[model samples]
Target chain A: MTAKTHSLERMIFFSDAVIAIMLTLLAVELPVPEVPDPLHLWGALAAHGSEYIAFLISFCVIAATWTAHHMLFVHVSRTDPQLITLNLLALLGYVLIPWASKTLGKVPNGAGVIVYATAMTFLGATMLLVLRHVVRSGLLDPTAPRGVISGIQAWSAMTTIMFALSIPAGFVLGRWTM
Target chain B: MTAKTHSLERMIFFSDAVIAIMLTLLAVELPVPEVPDPLHLWGALAAHGSEYIAFLISFCVIAATWTAHHMLFVHVSRTDPQLITLNLLALLGYVLIPWASKTLGKVPNGAGVIVYATAMTFLGATMLLVLRHVVRSGLLDPTAPRGVISGIQAWSAMTTIMFALSIPAGFVLGRWTM
Candidate 1:
C-alpha cells in the first residue's frame, strides 16, 4: 500500500476510535445512588426526577448529533489531512456533551440553556465548515449537487436557531414547573 | 460506479444515519416538566436524574459499539448483501436503545436491568456474528492476522460483561437513589 493510503487508514481508524470514546464518556458521570431505606424511596425519587428528565433530553440530543455526523461522512470515501483535522475539531465539541448535559441538568437555567445551545451551535457550525471544505476541496462525490452544501448550511442555521430558542424554553419551563 | 460500489456506499450511508439517529434517541425519554410547585419540580428532577444516569451509561456503550463497528469496517473496503443484513440486525438492536432508556427510566427495577442487558448482549453477539461473516467471506485485508478478529472478540466480550455487571449495579443504585 502507498504511504498516503496507510496514513488515511490510520486517520480514519484513530478518528473513529476517538469519536466513539467521546460519545461513550457521557455515561461516566452517572452518580449511583445508595438506597438506605426502601420505604423512603419515594422521597429520593422526588428529589432526583429532574435529573432523569435532563438525562433523557441530552441523550436524544447527542444521538441526533451523532446521526448528523454520520450523514456528513457518508459522501467521504477518503480523507485528506485537512479533512481529518476538521473532523477532529468537530469531535472536540462533541466531547463536551457531558458537560453540557450536567449544566442543563442542574439548573435548567437561562445560562445553562444558552451554554448548551452555544455548544450545539458551535458543533453545527463546525460541521458546516467541514462540509464547505469538502465541497471546495472536491473531496465530496462529484455526483452530489453543489446545492447539498447549501442544504447543510441551511440546516445548520435552522438547528442553531432551534438550539438557541430551547435555552429560554428550558428556563421558562424550569421556572413554571416549580 | 460499479453496482458493488454503489451498494457499499448505500450501506455505509444507511449505517451512519441509523447509528446517528440511535445516538440521538438516547435522550428522548427525558421529562420536560411544567412547573406546578416546588415539590413537583424537585420530583421531576429526581426522576429525570435516574434516567440521565442510564442515558449516560448507554451513551458510552453506544460510542464503544460504534468504535467497534468502525474498527470492523476498517480492514474491509467492501461488503456483501449478507454482511449488510447482519449489520442491519446489529443496528436494529441499537435502534432499540431509546426504548430501553425509556423502560429503565420508568421502572428502575431488576427486570428493567435484565431487559437492558439482554438488549446489549444481543447487540454484542450480533456484532460478533457480523465480524465472523466478514472474515469467512474473505472480505478482509489478506495482510491482516487472524488475531484481529480475536482482538475484536475479546473487546466485545469484556464490553458485554461490563454491561451485565452494570445492569444489576444500576438497579441497586436506582433503588437506593429513589
Candidate 2:
C-alpha cells in the first residue's frame, strides 16, 4: 500500500466541515433563556449576559481565524503529510472553542478562562507553525504576487502574538476577554 | 444588490464547517463525571454510558449525512438559489442533531427520542428534496455516471424512509433505538 497525495479541494473540504460544525455549535451553547412569556424574553436573555458575551467573543474569534486560514490557502495549491497533520492539530483547538466558551461562561474566572485561552493559544501557535512550514517548504504557488508571502508572514506573526497575549489576558481579565 | 452565484468550493466549504461544528459539539454534551483520582475514571465514565451511546449514534448519523452530501456535490458543478436554500434547510436540521441527542440522552423516552428522530426525519426528507431539485433543475454534471445518479437517488429515498419510520419507532422503542 502507498500513501496517497490529497488534492487541495479535499483538504479544504475536510477543514470547512470542521469549521462549519464548530461555528454552529457555538450557537447551541448560547444560553437559551426560558422566556415563559413574550414579556420576559429579552429580559431572560439579558440575565445570561455572560453566556451571550462568551458566545459573541468565540464567534468573532472563529470567524477571524477562518478568514486567515482561507486567505492562506488562497495562495496554497498543494499539500503534504506534515502540513495536513499540522492543520489537523489546529482544527482540533478550533473545534474546541465552544467547550472553552462554556467553561468561561460557567466559571468566568482565571481557572476557567485560562482553559479557553490556552486552547486558543495552542491554535494560534500552531497556525504560525503551519505558515512557517508553508514558507520553509516552498509551498507557495510560484508566480504569485511578490507581496503575498510577506503579507501572510506578517499577518501570522500578528495573530500569533495576539493569541499568545490572550492567554495572559485571560488571567488578568478573568473571562472578560477571549 | 444582485444575487450572486456561488462556486462549488464555497458551498462545500460552508457545508463542511457546519458538519465539523455539529460533530464536535456532540462530544461536549457527553456526561463527564468528575474523577478526582485516576482509579475511578472508568467507573465515572460508565455512569454516563447512555450519554456515550447517544453520542456514538449521533456521530455515525452525522458522518453518514456528510458522506451523502459530499458525494452529491461531487456530481454537481454549480448551484442556484433553490439548491442552496434546500441545502440550508437540511443543514438547519443537521446542526440540530446534537441538541436533540442531548435531549434523548437526558430523557431517554418517547418524548425525547421522537424529537431527535423528527430532526433526522427533516434532514432525510430535505435531502431527498435536494436530490429531486438536482434532477429537475438539470444540475448534475453531464458526464456523471448514470448508475451513480440513480444510486444516490435510491439511497436518499431509502434513508428518507428509514428516518420517517424512526419517528414512529421512537414511540414503539421508547429510546431503545437511535
Candidate 3:
C-alpha cells in the first residue's frame, strides 16, 4: 500500500488493458464470408487479401510492441506521472495503428502506406524514448542489467529504421503493399 | 520479487494487452465514409446510428469491467495457478466481445444482441466468481476492509443480473438495443 506501488500498479493495470484491447482489435478487419457457393468463399476472401494482410501486419506489430513493453516493465522499478504519461503516449501510437491499417486496407494507396509506416515508426521511437528514460532516470532496479536495456535499444532501432524506410519505399512501389 | 508478484504481473500484463486491443477494435465497425458528394458525408456517418450505438455500449461495458477488475485487484494479495487460470478465462470473455459486437453490428438481430448480451453476462459472472474465490480463499490483504468486498459484490451482482436479463428480453422485444 505504499504510494509508489499503487502508482505503478495503476500504470501496469491500465497498460495491460490497453494492450489487450488493441491486440484483439486486429481481427476487426476480417469479415464473415457470405458467398452463396461454398467453393467461391475462398476466392471471395482472397479478394480482400489487402485487409487480411493489413490485419496480420498490424497484429504482429502490436504483439511485438507488447512484448517489448512487458520486457521493459520487468526492469521498471518506479513510475512517476511523467513516466505514466510517456507510456500513455506510447499507447496512443498503438491506438493509431488500427486507423492506419484500416486506411491502408481500404485504399491500399501510397498515402495510406506512408501513414501506416509513419505510425509504426512513431511507436518504435516512443518505445525507444521510454527505454532511454527508464535507464537514464534510475527508474529501473539497480540489479537490472545494462544488457537488457542495450538489447531493447538494438531492437527498437531496427524497428524504427525498417518502418521509416517503408515510407519512401511505399511511394516508389506505387502501391502501399508494404 | 515474490512468485506471487510475478504471476500477478504476468496476468495483469496479458489482460491489459487484451483489453486494450478489444476496446479499440470497436471502431472497426465504423466505415471510412466514401461519399462522392462531400455534402452527404455527415448524413452518411449519421446513417449507421445502430452501429455507433453498439460500439458505445460495448465500449462502456469493457471500460466498466476493466474498472471493476482494477478495483478488485487492489485487494488481491496472493496468486496461484488456479487464480491465474480463472483470470485468463475471464479475459477470454473480453476476447469474445469483439466477435459478439461484430455480429450485432452486421446483423442487428435478436440473435446478435442476445449473443452480445450473453458475452457481457459471462464477463460479469466470471468477475463475480473471481471475487468470491478471492474472498473465500483468503487471498485478499489482511488490511482490506470488508465493506470494499461487499460493495464490489453488489456491483458485480448488478452487472450480472442486467446483462443476463437482456437475453429473454431480447426475444420478447425482437431486438436487443441495449
Candidate 4:
C-alpha cells in the first residue's frame, strides 16, 4: 500500500473505533434512579422521564449523524492528514456527549442549558467543518456522477436546525427542571 | 466506474438514507399528550413519562446498532447482490420501529410487549445474517487485519443476548403495562 493508503486505513480504523465507543458511552450516563417499592419505582421512573426523552433525542440524533458520516466516507477512497485530523476533531465532539448529558440532565438551570447547547452547536459545526475539508481536499472522486456538495450542504443545514432548536429548548427545559 | 462499484454505491446510499430516516422517525413517535387545561400540562407530561423511557432505550439500542453496522462495513471493500438484499432486510426491521412504538404505546400490554420484543429479535438476527453473508462473499480482503469471523461471532453472540433479554423483558414490561 502507498503511504497515503496506509495512513487512510489507520485513520479509518481509529475513527470507526472512537465513534463506536462514544455511542456506547451514552447509556452509561443514565443512572438507574433509586426506588425500592414497585409503586415508588414507577413514580421515580415517571418523575425523571424527561431525562429519558432527552437521552432518546440525543441518541437518535447521534445515529443520524453517524449514518451521514458513513455515507460520506463510503465515497472517500482515501484521506489526507488534514482530513483525518479534522474528522478526529468531529469525533471528539461526539465523545464529549457523556459530559454534555450530565450537564443537560441537571437542566432547568441556565448554565447547564447553555453548556449543553454549546456542546451540541460545536458538535454540529465541527462536523460541517470536517465535511468541508474532505470535499475541498478532492478526496472525493472527480467523476463521482452525483453532486456530493448538495448533500453535504443539506446535512449541514439540518445539523444547524437541530442546534438552533436545542438552544431555546434547553433553556425552557432547564427552567422547567429547576 | 465498474458495475460492482456503481451497484455498491447505490446500495450504500439507499441503506444509509433509510437508516437515517428511521432513526429520525423514532423521535417523531413521541407525541405531545393532549391536554385541554394548560395548568394540567405538567401532569400529562408526568403521566406519559414511561413512553419517554421506552423511547430512550430503543433509541440507544438503535444507535448502537448503527454503530455496529458502520464498523462491520469498514472491512467490506465491495458488495454483492445477495449481501445488499440481506442488508435491506436488516434495515426493514429498523424501519418497522415506529409502528412497533405505536403498538406498544397504545396497548402497553402483554401482546404489544411481545410484538416489540419479536421485532427487536428479528432486527438483530437479520443484521447478523447480513454480516455473515458479507463476510462469506470474499469481497473483503481476506488478509485484512480485522478477523471477520471473530467480529461477526462476537456481534452474533451479542445479538442473541439482546434478543434473549428482549423477550423476557418484554414479558415483564407487558405484564406491567397490562
Candidate 5:
C-alpha cells in the first residue's frame, strides 16, 4: 500500500473506533429496572419505556451514520488534513449523542428534546462537511461512479436539514418531536 | 473487491467497532471526585488514586490489544467462519474488561484482581487462537513475513502466560497484584 492509503486507513480506523464507542455508550448508563418481586419485573421494565425508546432511537441514528461513513469511505482512496479535521469534528458531535440520549430519557422535556436535536444536527452537519471536503478535494477513487457520489452527498444534505429543522420542532412538539 | 474481501472487511470493521467500544467503556463509569470547595479538589481526586490507576492500566491493555490485532490483520487477507467466531469470543472477553476494572477499583480484593487477570488472559489467548487459525488455515497473504507472524504469536503467548500467573499472585499479594 502507498503511504497515502496507509494514512487513509488509519483515519478510517480511528473514526470507526470513535463511532463504535459512541454507539455502545448509549447503553452504558441505561437503568436496569429494579423490582420488589418477580411478578413486578415486567411492570418495572414497562415503566422505563421511554429510556428504552431513547436508546433504540440513538442506536439507530449512530448505526445509520456509521453506514453512511462506511459507504463514503469505500469510494475514498486517500485523505487530506482538512478531511481528517472534519472527521474529528464530526466525531466530537457523535460523542455527545449518548449524553443527549440520557438527558432526553431523564427529562423528556422541551429542553431535553432540543439538546438531542441539536446534537444530531451538529453530527449530520459535520458529516456533510466531510463529504463535501472529500468531493471538492478529489479524494475519491478515479473510477467512483458519479451517481453514487451525488447520492451520498444528497442523502447527507437531506439528513442534516431534517435534523436542523427538528430543533425548532422540539419547541412546538415537545418530546413528540423525537 | 471480491465477495471474500468484502466479507473480511466487514469482519474487520465489526471487530474494530467492538474494540473501540470496549476501550471507551473503560472511562464511561469513572467517578468524578466530588469536593465541597475548590481547595479540596486535588485531595478529593487523590483519594481515588486506585481507580485512576485501574483505568490507565486497562486503557493501555486494550490499546495494546488493538495494536496487536491491527498488526496481525495486516497480514491476513481473508477470514473464515471459525476465525470470525474466535474473534467474537475474543470480544466477549474484551467487553468484560471495563466491568473487571470497575470491580478492581471498588473492591481492590483478591477476587477482583483475579477477575481482571482472567479477563486479560482470556483475551490474549483468544487472540492467539486467531493468529494460529490464520496461519494454519492459510488466511494470511502469500507475501506476509514469517518473522512477523511468529513474533505476534510469541508476544501473545507470553502476555497470556503473564496474566495467568498473576491470577495466583492475586491471592497472595492482594491489590498489589495489579
Candidate 6:
C-alpha cells in the first residue's frame, strides 16, 4: 500500500478500535449478582433488570453506529484532516456512552433517560456529520456506487432522527425510552 | 479484495477490536474520586493510587500485546481455522484483564497480585501460542523477512517469561508485582 492508503487504513483502524472499546465498555458496568443462597440468585438478577436493559439498549446503539461507520468507510478511499477531526468528535460522544448507560441503569428515571438519549443523539449527529463530510469532500472511491452511498446516508439519517426524537420521548416513556 | 483476503482482514480486524476493548476496559474500573471540598480532591486521588497503578500496568500489557499482534499479522498473508481458534484463546485471557485489574486495585494484597499476575501470564502465553502457530503453519507472506519473525518471537517469549516470573514475585512484593 502507498503511504496515502496506509494513512487512510490507520484512520479506519483507529475508529474501529474506539467503537469496539465503547461497545465492550457497556458490559463493564453490569453488576455481578450476589445472593446469600442459590435460590435468591434469580431474584437478585431480576432486581437489576434495568441495568441489563440499559446494557442491551446501549449495545444496540453502538453496534448500529459501528455498522454505519463500517459501511461509510468501505466506500471512502481517502481522508482529510477535517474527516479525522469529525471522526474524533463522534468518538467523544461514543466514549461517554458507558457513563450514560451506567447512570441510566442506576437511576432508570426521566433524568436518566434524558442523559442517555442526549448522548445517543450527539453520537448519531456527529456520525452524520462525518458522512456528510466524506461525501461533500469527495473522499470516496471513484467507483463507489451511488446506491450504496444513498443507503448509508438514509440509515444514518434515520438513526439520528430517532435518537433526537427520543429526548422528548424520555419524559413520556420514562425507562421505556430505552 | 478477494474473498480470502477479506476473510483474513476480517480476522485481523476482529482481533484488533478485542484488544482495543480490553485496553480501554482497564480505565472503566477506575473509581471517580469524589470529594466534598476541592482541597480534598488530591488526597482522595492519592488514596486510590493503587487503582491508577493497576490501570497503567494493564494498559501497558495490552498495548504491548497489540503491538506484537499487529507486527505478526502484518506478515501473515493467510489464516486457518486453528489460527482463528488460537487467536480466540488469546482473547479469552485479554477479556479477563479488566476484572483482574479491578480486583488488584481493590485488594492490593498478595492474593490480588497473584490474580493479576496469573492473568497477565495467561494472556502472554496464549499470545505466544498464536505466534508459534502462525509461524509453524506457514501463514506468513513469502516476502516476510526472517529477522522480523525472530524479533517478534523474542518479544513474545520475553513478555511471557516475565509475567510467569511475576507470579512468584507476587508473594514477596505484593502490590509491587504490578
Per-residue lDDT over A25-62 for candidate 4, one digit per residue giving the tens place of the 0 to 100 score: 45434444443332344464567676666566666676
Residue B24, model 2, lDDT: 80
TM-score per prediction, in order, is 0.53, 0.54, 0.58, 0.54, 0.58, 0.57
lDDT of 4 at A177: 74
Which ranges of candidate 2 are over 4 A from the true structure? A1-10, A16-178, B1-9, B175-178
Question: Which regions in candidate 4 have their CA more than 4 angstroms from the true location?
Answer: A35-41, A168-178, B1-178
In candidate 4, position A112 carries an lDDT of: 62
lDDT string, candidate 2, A18-90, tens digits: 7877788778867668888998888998888887888898888788778878878888767765776677667
Q: Give each model's whole-structure lDDT.
A: 0.66, 0.72, 0.75, 0.66, 0.78, 0.76
Task: Locate the minimum summed-lDDT window of 10 residues in model 5 chain B.
Answer: B32-41
Arrange candidates by DockQ, descending: 3, 2, 6, 5, 4, 1
Angstrom error of the Cα, residue A103, model 4: value is 1.5
Q: Going through the candidates in order, what fraction of the true interface contacts does each contain?
A: 0.00, 0.19, 0.26, 0.00, 0.14, 0.14
In terms of lDDT, the poorest run of 10 residues in model 5 chain A is A169-178
Which residue pairs show backbone clashes in model 6? Answer: none
Predicted candidate 2, C-alpha RMSD: 9.2
**lDDT agreement of model 1 with the native:** 0.66
Task: For all candidates, state DockQ relative to the true structure.
Answer: 0.03, 0.11, 0.14, 0.05, 0.08, 0.10
- A-chain TM-score per prediction? 0.74, 0.84, 0.92, 0.83, 0.92, 0.91
Candidate number with greatest DockQ: 3
lDDT score at residue A111, model 2, on the 0-100 scale:
43
Candidate structures ordered by TM-score, highest first: 3, 5, 6, 2, 4, 1
Worst 10 residues of 4 chain A by lDDT: A31-40
What's the i-RMS of each model? Answer: 8.6, 7.0, 5.9, 10.6, 8.5, 7.6
